[model samples]
Target: MTERSRHLSVHVDRPVAEVYAFASDPANLPLWAPGLGGPLVHEDGAWSVLTPHGRARLEMTPLNEHGVLDHVVTTPSGERVHVPLRVVADGAGSEVVFTLRRAPGTSEEEFEQDAERVNADLALLKQVVEAGAAGGAGGPAGA
Candidate 1:
């Protein structure tokens, strides 16, 4: 089958729970997520996100068929993005595994660009969370 995937891993100098608490909450994307803006959320699982290039409305459907938490979001460009978030322990730090898969229609170049942008956001997430963990500047992304 044709597929696209992006794997991003980061070591946050914080407890796994702390890192997971911030990263897992999509609503806080605006505060820490780079190249994206606004996490306007709704009661029915719909969210509005503003990208550097444009805006997107994401509709999330949570599924519990397996032991993992799985969600699918519809991108602003009409592409469905599948995401799997996993948290692992690594001694004094924490490891985050992000698996992204999408179908084709857009060029690989475009995908690569998007990946870079998204990866930058992930890196910022680590920074923001770790920065907060040390009692330096970690506040609710929404707060």
Candidate 2:
């Protein structure tokens, strides 16, 4: 069986570095990506959150100048899901792209629901970033 994927993107009225700085911080996940669930807790040199599926561990890529926000979520059942995210320069603004992939045995309806959730998350991200930009803050918490 072939896996399917959807690339959802949103435009933020901020520089790539600013957007990356905000979105790259796990502490800001609750502000935009609420689908990930409650606040992130940093423990034992790792970040974990209380997701709908229970506690899940998150491993994000190190901060870099390349604008890569890739992360892996280890589900309660020990399923490691890779989420590919990026912030690319779009003129003076930036475009955030998130790739949502269909897992094996997932139904079409489930995939569509996932896509919708991602779209909503991206929209929220745009609003938060733009609002912060308007406030003269380079990024979230001035990061």
Candidate 3:
């Protein structure tokens, strides 16, 4: 089966290092990614979150200088999913991109939905980071 990936990127009006610093911190997940950002509990070498679907475990990449934010998400049914994320320098600002893969046997609708979700999350990330860079607290995006 050929693997297909969809990329969604957002430009944040902040330095690449600053953006990576904030995004690489798992603690800030809830501030930008509301969907997957819940209270995380570490148990048995994995971070667990009570997702609406069920209990899910996430293993994200450690803080690194290469701007890699990949993560492994395991569902309650024991399915392991890999999500590739990156942050790169874009002139005076930063560009954050998320790669969503279309799993084998996944329906087209499901893939589109996944892309939409990622887009919304990226938008939130851009808003939060830009707001902080503008000397404002992390308020609602576009507020």
Which of the numbered candidates is closest to the native, going by highest lDDT? 2
Question: Per-residue lDDT for 1-143 in model 3, tens only?
Answer: 43698889999888777788788776678778876747777777767787877888888897676788899999889988888999887878888999888989889998898788888999989998888833422311221
Better of 1 and 3 by TM-score: 3
Please, what is the TM-score per model?
0.68, 0.90, 0.84
Candidate 1 per-residue C-alpha lDDT over 1-143 given as tens digits, one digit per residue, 9 for 90 to 100: 34767777777777655665665566666656646556455555567676654666654434222213235556667766666666566676677666655456768887777677667876887888877832322322322
Poorly placed runs, candidate 2 (over 4 Å): 133-143
TM-score, model 1 to reference: 0.68
* Candidate 3: C-alpha lDDT: 0.79
Model 2 C-alpha RMSD vs. true structure (Å) is 3.5
Full candidate order by lDDT, most accurate first: 2, 3, 1
Runs of candidate 1 exceeding 4 Å displacement = 36-39, 43-45, 50-70, 76-79, 133-143
Model 2, 1-143: lDDT tens digits are 33998899999988877898788888788889997777789998999999777899999998777788999999999988999999888878989999999999999999999999999999999999888832332332322
lDDT: the better of candidates 1 and 3: 3
lDDT of 1: 0.60
lDDT of 2: 0.85
* Stretch of 10 with least lDDT, candidate 2: 134-143
